[model samples]
Target: MNMSVPFSLLFTLIILFLSVLISSTSAKKPGDASQDLVRSSCVHASYPNICLRSLSSYSGPANTPGEVAQAAVKVSLSRARKASNYLANLRSQSKREQGAFHDCVEQMGDSVDELSKTLSELKHLRSGSFRWQMSNAETWVSAALTNEDTCLDGFKEVTGKVRSDVKRKVTNLARVTSNALYLINRLDQSRQKTP
Candidate 1:
């Protein structure tokens, strides 16, 4: 006959098995609660805008006020001129590329003409408006976006750049002008205060 198991040994084994199970369960790590939280990291460091800091800190050249104005106007006019040049180039190319379905490009070319003309007007308008344009640069930015939308309409893959470039130049000019005018006003206020 088989010998019966010792009661004390069986109890010891049961207790050992229970202790292992309890230890394993207690040792489980809690996952971090914040791991599930969505965090969008910073897209860009907040830089002070309008190149003011850049201009202010600029020790490379002692830029005169009129020199600054001249430089800015030159930059703006150059952009307008480039936009005009792009339209001219596109017009020339469209003249060469006209075909069956492609014949519609002539109309697009005409649309480009319209857009270019508006851009030119805006370019000149920006010059005159530079004294006090855009009560809010953000609102000005929104308007530029509208201008972008208008430019993008009926545009093919090609002029997407032309449209975007036009918007960028125009917007940049507006920003520069705002900064210059603000500087001017500040200077005038300081002069009044001193004298």
Candidate 2:
């Protein structure tokens, strides 16, 4: 009789433990799961905080490394577009620094195009074509980042309100583009190490 009581108590405890475990695991929201993925993937990035900040705003959960890379590219595209528009507006307003503003506008336009190409390549990345697609995307994003730097370089001699304005926008875009590149490189490395 005593053994039967102990067995029943032990079974009850086991059942309780399993219930708690199941509830805890199931209680995690999709957002929480994706956030975990984001954090883990960002650990591989050069600028982890920027990567997380830029990608965490994506509406759906980025469940895979590819999804995270896609999100990063999208964020880069959006930032590049904004920078292009800002430079275009600055070019229109420029009276004294026409040459510098024009050059910056052209460089930013190129940067936007490169970023768009990166996004396009990333969008088409499939399991069978991961390496080649990632390589192309990386090249495009790197070129975009270079263009942003070149835009700032064009303003080295020009010191005025125009330089300051262009500098601010270009710097912001460059940082975001750099973050995207880091994430892409991370994704590539991670995939290579898998299987």
Candidate 3:
């Protein structure tokens, strides 16, 4: 007796098996509460798209507003650090716009420091001093946003590719920082509302 599966049946079985395997290995689940919470938190951000995009890779539990704020601050801090490094490297290689690059690098450095403080404050928030800690986080994040804007402003008098590149990078950093600040403010408000 010769038993052979039809080619179409074999192909269909293989496809089905692969699909099942892929679905089983997928990380995201339908109606995931953590993901829902993350989306809701991002809704309140000034740059909601930017907030969601930046925060998409955050692996922390999104069970609370404070956690979302912490994640946002972490994203902002990461971007700020990268921008600072980029500026430093550009400064070393550039001839023209050296003064502007120098100032931008210094401002970006301050921005990184402020974002670091904000992240630290968020991480150590105490129930007894919740309001105070949130206030500090807010202040630090806002300061970081300002610092990023100042860096971009330094390029106003400059022209050409360097200026445009600096503007693009710094502006994006400022946007993400602004979104982080918005999320932080929301967390503070949420705390205030809880009895």
Candidate 4:
């Protein structure tokens, strides 16, 4: 009897549980969405211009933190799993897609720092006792704090000791890749129409 199937199922269940926990922690509390907590939202979406750059441009020395790209995004699934486990043990924050996000944040170093700081500030605003009461506020705060630390820590771990900007460029590339794919699909459809 091969146990791989059952083991695979078990592993999946564990990841799902972790994912649920992380998502629950990240959900916008009643306090988060209200006027009391409202903050600006910006265009963080991946743009197509970055995608057009050659892979050579994106590649950088793994140890050197350079502008645009400083670290290599060579993370594997197993490494991602380890990162998620580390984050899950942090006891305060929840990282949705903890595994995947670890990689993303590593690739988004400076961007991650800025994003974390912004999120941390938003968290502080909501946790203020003056805001309308929301259940799990304490849990939420703990999670936010944990996430802030985790973002910094994860950035370090995945960047292979490179600067934060390297991570940011990696994250930016992901968005650009998505945008490129979308454009390619659109072009393909248009070409089909020409026939």
Cα-based lDDT for every prediction: 0.38, 0.80, 0.84, 0.35
RMSD of 3: 6.6
Ranking by TM-score: 3, 2, 1, 4
Write the residue-wise lDDT of candidate 3 on 1-195 in tens digits.
889999999999999999999988885775376677889988867888888887777876667777888888888888888998888987434554788888888998998898898888988989999888888888888888888888887788888878888888889989998988888888888778889
**What is residue 130's positional error in candidate 2, in angstroms?**
3.1
- Report the poorest 10 consecutive residues by lDDT, candidate 2: 89-98
lDDT of 2 by residue, 71-135 (tens): 87788778878877877776434454677678777887888788888878877878898888888
Task: Candidate 4: list runs displaced more than 4 Å.
Answer: 1-48, 51-163
lDDT of 1 at 64: 38
Best by lDDT: 3
Instruction: List where candidate 2 sits over 4 angstroms from the true fold.
Output: 1-26, 91-96
- For residue 67, model 2's alpha carbon misses the true position, in angstroms, by 1.0
- On the 0 to 100 scale, the lDDT of residue 7 in model 3 is 98
Candidate with better lDDT, 2 vs 3: 3
Query: Model 3: residues >4 Å from true position, as ranges?
Result: 1-31, 91-96
In candidate 2 the C-alpha lDDT for residue 67 amounts to 80
Model 1, runs deviating above 4 Å: 1-48, 53-60, 63-159
Could you tally the backbone clashes for each prediction?
0, 0, 0, 9
Residue range with the least summed lDDT across 10 consecutive positions in model 1:
36-45
Best by TM-score: 3
Question: Quick one: ranking by lDDT, best first?
Answer: 3, 2, 1, 4
